[model samples]
Target chain A: MAVFVDLNISHTVDKKRLQNIIETAAHLGYSTVAINHVVDLQQKKQEIGKPKCVSELFDQFPIVQGKSRPIKVLNRLTLVVSEASHFRPTNEFKSYDVVAVFPKTEKLFHAACMSFDVDIICIAVTEKQPFYFKRPPVNGAIDRGVFFEISYVPAIKDSTMRRYTISNSLSLMETCKGKNVIVSSGAEKPLELRGPYDIANLGLLFGLSEGDAKAAVSTNCRAVLLHGETRKTALGIIHTMKKIEPTAERREEEEAPVLKRARTEAV
Target chain B: MVRFKSRYLLCELCVSDQSSLQLLDDRAVFTGVRGAVCRAHGDYGAALCSVSFAVKYLNADTGVVFLRCRKSHYRILWSALPFITHLENRGQKVPCAFNCLYVGGTIRTCQKFLIRYNIQQLHRMLPHCHNEAERLEVRRAVLNCSLKSLEKEEEEDE
Candidate 1:
């Protein structure tokens, strides 16, 4: 079975340890690695002295280009899902075999599907609690090892993604496992995450069939790294070329006034 | 859980007994994730253009809980939906990257000449799309939207 290990390469990661994991995943016969990041805009916000997003983070990663590295970074987008910049990372990295994302980009991902050239590897969060370890990998703290364990804030429901999902593709369905859309333990310590089968079973319980469930772990990921897919059922989208449809004028009239009143109240 | 926007208004869509949503018959709840509160008055169509249909349920203690599309990262899955439906309804064959047209649950053997098959490397598949209209449209949308957004930011700074 051809397996693609899902890995995220961040500047803050311990360079030596990260290299070891990449080699470990590679030695295990993985075909490619789906690279993603949170690409925290917290710094961007701090820099601009207000909330601001730079276009550079979305730029295609140059480090992954040289083939000498055992891992090939298929997906480039960070995991954060804001409305505007969410799709930019995917678009910039569309040349890769797979794209990575969380729930936040759902609307834009769908709206801009066709513009991409890869399959989506949705990151399913396995742990229930919301934990973020700022450690060895993440520069924010050079901290690591399952940063979050407990939270004053409630853990988001299984289906509820921290950021709204954009593109719910076969690849993403497999990698993320299910409710928790992430792979990084947010730590420096090596965490023994539930392997592919374990992850796929979670998806099965959450409404995916055995085939789709398996694809989320095995084939969807392989297809992404191997650079294409075969099954006729698989889907792809062109971002701009949309088939426009006529609107229901009747519905428009009815919803019109209630919204208008609400707007007046909001302002 | 059902979440309803009681006071807000929406264009009432014709609802069938088997429609995806049942609570608000003929009504699609329009919610803005952006917290742009005044958005409703200016644009009703775009306001309701959410990833999934969310209706307000009067009974919830919390405010409206949106249904996020947490399925496969369907590349432009939302955008191509109308097109796919239209093409299928019209009995048009949507092109697949492997050269053969795919639709109606089977691949047409009539090979499209543009793509070549490499049995040794199935990963390097050619574009399934036979046309460029969608590509150009996406490029334009990104450039236009990004520009407009950038301009809006600049104006606010001044």
Candidate 2:
């Protein structure tokens, strides 16, 4: 089974609340969750600092229901860009596992979708989508393996926000044809978080087909994680560190068992 | 006999306070679901939903609800079930959401599944009882329910 993942839990100042949210996520069968720290550069002098260590969130990580493994927590940084200069890729961007961009204008939206090397382009949930999702940029993002994210927490919190969330996601789905889209809960509290299956069903209301809706919770999120991994290496290869020596004896011994079994079967 | 095609949804209304469940009934649930579908899926969904949607059974005590809809449009209604945050009743609002447990082709199958699902839930709750008294009480309840259900099944079989 594809392990369910909720890749956008909103980072909160209250440690206890954040811990409760993560525990609820684990109980809801999320195998992995990303704590998103948002930076709105529209505010003056907003410095993007390194994300806090995810390990400090809990003493022992809560085990995912039905999976019997501790939920994997990851750090993410989201930059809300209103203007062109709002987003700058500093070394701080490399500290997090996933980077997301919420563009506030048509220019920034196009830029974030096409040229920006972020993993996710966050669609507006709290308000109406400011600019229309033009075909070229959205298609370019998909071609570049970047995912468009729609957060559901806002919908849970308010009815007006629910209208925006459903409309915005439908617009994105219209142009993207439900490809390379991820639905995540930007839940600041435990109550805002819904189960993965619930979100998958909610995706249908967002204009996604049944299979694509399920993928929004599982496979597409995995693709986004892999996209983040590739950003760290050169073409996903060519590491700067020296290579370690392999044990030739161990390699031969590992090969010998399979070979001996094959020879015995042949005899 | 020609039978009309229909779908039955077995759902559980999750509420923080059990007292709030009393406020939920067939009409309130119907209104909540209709409003949610209209808001989320729009007028077209609302029109499609009013076709044959009905609340067949509702157990306020256990929070179980059986919603019946046309087979062709059950998916649309199923998608809207999660959006129901609360049901308004008698000038008061109760915070709750519906978690769909099973969708069956017939009410008979849904009832069968609900019994099995309730038993599984009871088994899960047994370990969480706080003290010896609570544990024993839960055990007796479980045994009583199983015996009653088994006897009912035997009567039906005969």
Provide a comma-separated list of chain B TM-scores, one per candidate.
0.16, 0.86
* CAPRI class of candidate 2: acceptable
Instruction: Please give, for residues A12-112, the per-residue lDDT of candidate 1 as tens digits.
Output: 34545544444433423344554344443333442211111222222322221112233444333443444545334322343333334332344433433
The 10-residue segment of model 1 chain B with minimum total lDDT is: B96-105
* lDDT tens readout by residue for model 2, A157-245: 77798889989999999999999999998887665677777778889888899899999999999999988876654445422332355
Candidate 1 local lDDT, residue A5: 50
What does candidate 2's lDDT look like per residue over B126-156, in tens digits? Answer: 6557899998887787567545765577457
Model 1 lDDT at residue A35: 37
Interface RMSD values, listed in order for every candidate: 18.2, 2.5
Error of 2 at A29 (Å): 3.2
Determine which window of 10 residues in candidate 1 chain A has minimal summed lDDT. Answer: A144-153
lDDT of 2 at A189: 65
Worst 10 residues of 2 chain A by lDDT: A234-243
lDDT of 2 at A178: 99
| Number of the top DockQ candidate | 2
lDDT of 1 by residue, B60-81 (tens): 2211122222123211222211
DockQ of each: 0.01, 0.28
